[model samples]
Target: MRKLALNDEILLKIEKPARYIGNEVNSVMKDKNEVDIRFAMCFPDVYEIGMSNLGMAILYDMFNKREDVWCERLFSPWTDLDKIMREKKIPLFALESQEPVRDFDFLGITLGYEMCYTNVLQLLDLSQIPFLAKERGEEFPLVIGGGACAYNPEPLAEFFDLFYIGEGETAYDALFDAYIANKKAGGTKKDFLLKAAQIPGIYVPAFYDVTYQEDGTIASFTPNQPEAPSKVEKQLVMDMDRDYNFLEAPVVPFIKATQDRVTLEIQRGCIRGCRFCQAGMIYRPTRERDIEDLKEAARIMLKNTGHEEISLSSLSSSDYSELKELVNFLIDEFRDKAVNISLPSLRIDAFALDVMSKVQDVKKSSLTFAPEAGSQRLRNVINKGLTEEDILHGAGQAFEGGWNRVKLYFMLGLPTETEEDMKGIAHLAEKIAERYYEIPKDKRNGKVQINVSTSFFVPKPFTPFQWAPMFREEEFIEKAKIVKNEIRSQLNQRSIRYSWHEPDVTVLEGFLARGDRRSSKVILKAYEKGALYDAWSESFRYDIWKEAFAETGVDMEFYTLRERDTDEILPWDFIDAGVSKEFLIREWKQAKAETVTPNCRQRCSGCGAKRYGGGVCHEGQN
Candidate 1:
């Protein structure tokens, strides 16, 4: 029996106390004395949200599979427990061993979203570790970060010792071997980091020097250490069908996670090159798992976790070649058990409508479409492949198939957006409602329910929009009003429901996303002044961040509202994310010209992902 880090008194006082308890089903446990390395995998958010991340789950299973490495898990304690623990002076501990995280050899954090920046500081603070990497010595755990946000690690560079530049499966084994060798040789921590920096896709921020221009733009970013590479390439798994690449068993949470289901990742990377999308540009040359492998994974995962619902995880599910076969296998294999299948991010064509009819309850589920922008011209500028004809055709097919509920997603404040574009969103929603009414009275399910949602655009690194300027919060709110008023004047005003995302949160995200190394102080100052859980709406404090920025002398407008020149030295130039800067520049020019580029399937744009020698780039080739 293992003693929990939290006592019964503390457990009883906190909400969802099960979050701190370990020994959940499928969770790996190992003897500490037998293992040479102890790694604490963290997902920075609350337990429920953190457990739902498939990347963390996959990496956790991968690390624990090694006999010499005993990997555990940790999450940012909720505000209730966060205060209690601080009062009691209880160090943050890993769930598996109930040991203080400060004792671990490695603490790897997943940086999936920019909003979780403040939560990282909370974790380090609770663990009793120094906030700044340079302030820590060998006695502390080597803190590292990875995920989509790692592409722009400079904003948080001073805090993290190193960052894994890409997919966890590609380079972790080599990194671990290097660490073990260094330990056996009795090498210092700096010596081990020097060795780690030499490995592909490993970046030691402390080893590099970033010099800023007088105007605060990064003048030059070069490595000071001989071991650190001048350009760190993004790593990805070329063959996703390898048995070790996909997670075999996910740890069942004691409490229901946000994603409470069996998640089967069908593929990695996206073929559609949307100019505003970061994932599409960063994860280049999409690779998919075999259908047979997927079927086996679904079976084993469902059986192991006993989850009633299984979701197909992918950027775009419709693009997977074997989707029909896999979906059919899932339906037939588990028909007796009556398992629920979730297929998100699918094009609502005739074939997809047919699949959804079989897998989902039309009455309870709503068909979703992300047109992204309103008018065709705006869509072309953003390189969104979906057109008005496609949207209406899909919606009409869904209505005819006995579906009355529809969700349409759009982005406001996009580059080149005008009043006409803003009003076009309402016009599109009304057009979809008109399609639903086209059905005969008896044939229709009931009154149509159209839910229109719009999120303010935030420019992300490595995308064509990286050079774009974001609108102010007031301007964003005014744009939201334009759509709201347009919807009110529509013919089907009663049937449509409209909601816009809070612009304040979006502005902060933009600041974090585009900021350089100097922005780290703002995050630290914000966290020091009770800025934990900025990701959660209830706990977010825009005022706190505003004050932090003012105090730290970080002009948020410089990072968010300034449109950069094509030749400007962006903070993330040091890392190569497969897509060449030349290709991105070309796409930026194409966007300004309102030209459309074909996806990976239709035509090759020569985006430099071909260097990996795999994925759609080599499909149908020798």
Candidate 2:
């Protein structure tokens, strides 16, 4: 019998014992004694939240497919179980094997967002692992970070031994083989790290030394070790249909998960180059999975998991050339089985409205639109490529389709945003409400509920807006008030609801998103001062972060408030994200000129993903 860290008594006391239990339907079970590498894949969030992550699921399934690797799932315990485990001195364990994560050969934590820095620390502390990467020895698990946040890994460099930049599918096979060979040769941890740094996508922060100018800007960042490359190019899996594993039998959770359904990734990357979107820029040159493959994956996953619904996952679902075909196929195939198809990240076009009408309940469901900016001019500035006319037309179509509720997403504190632009958000919402009223009273399904939400935009690395300056908390709030006041003054006040994200969290995210190696001290200090689950508004302590910044002598304003010159070197400059800096700089200039550039599909802007000779560029040549 495998030894469980949590006993029966402890498990019984926790709210969801299923979260800690090892066995779940379709969860990979391997003989630890047989495998050479024990990989514990973790998402530094609650079980429900982590289980919903498709990337984690794909990686877990991929790793387990290797004969010599025993890969198991791990997630940060909820407060209830967390308290009991810490008090009882029970080390954190993987869900499949119920073995302590400390004993695992590799601990891969996916850093999808900046807010999870504290939770990463909590995971380490609970696992009885050293908080800092430097403090651990050969006996300790090699901590690796990946995902979107790993693109800008400076704020987290001190904690993770190495960061795997870019797509997970491209580099892991080489990584595992190297690890197994090193283990056989009885290599030291330093030796393994040096070898790991030799891999194309692997970035070992300790091998790089960063010097700062008197003004706290990065003066120079040079590689110390000969093995470590000066520039770590992000790995891109070009052939999605061939290389990508559409996870066939994802582990079915016994309890409810955030996304309690089979998720089929229809595509990777986005064609629309929204300037503020980090995902769009980082995941360059759009690639769509074959429709036949998607159908098979969807069928197998749903059948294995016995899920009631299946979601088509992608950055932009509507942009997928075969979206209609895929969605229709899913509906036709799963209709008899009573499996609903969830199509998110869609443009509110006529086709989308028609498809949505079939799958969703018109009364209960709310149609979501990410206008990104409130005004057309501002939309052009951000390269959103969405017009005000598109919003009204889409809303009208939805109203006609018997959808009453509409959720509109916008970003506050965008570069060069005016008070008029803020009011435009309300104007757009009000127009949507009016469109609802335009429908004949007898023809209408229900009352209109337009929810307008704004989040403060934090400039991210590898984006045209990377040099954009973030507003102070007060400025963000004041701008939000401009929209709120305009909404309240509208005739559709009752139908429209206005809400904005917490400015404090936005400020913190801005700091972390663009911070350098020096900013890692602030994160460490904040975690030491009891910062966990900073993503949750209720759990965030701004004062603690403030104190950490002060103590570390790191100014948050230096990261958030200052706009960089076009020629200045950024913290993430070394990581070649495939999207050229020259292209981004050009786009930035276009934004300033209020000139809209067409997407990759329309015309090649020469973003340098073409150099990879894949995705849209390859197809364009054909």
User: How well does model 1 score by local distance difference test?
Assistant: 0.93
Query: Which candidate leads the pack in TM-score?
Result: 1
lDDT tens string, model 2, 248-329? 9999898999999989898888888999999998888788888888888887887788999988899999988898888888
| Global fold similarity of model 1 (TM-score) | 0.99
Clashes of each: 0, 0
Model 1 lDDT tens row, 62-115: 998899999999999999999999999999999999999999999999999999
TM-scores of the models, in the order given: 0.99, 0.98
Residue pairs clashing, model 1: none
Residue 463: error of model 1 in Å? 0.5
| Candidate 1: residue 593 lDDT (0-100) | 96
- Which ten residues in a row are the worst by lDDT in model 1? 239-248
Where is model 1 more than 4 Å wrong at Cα? none
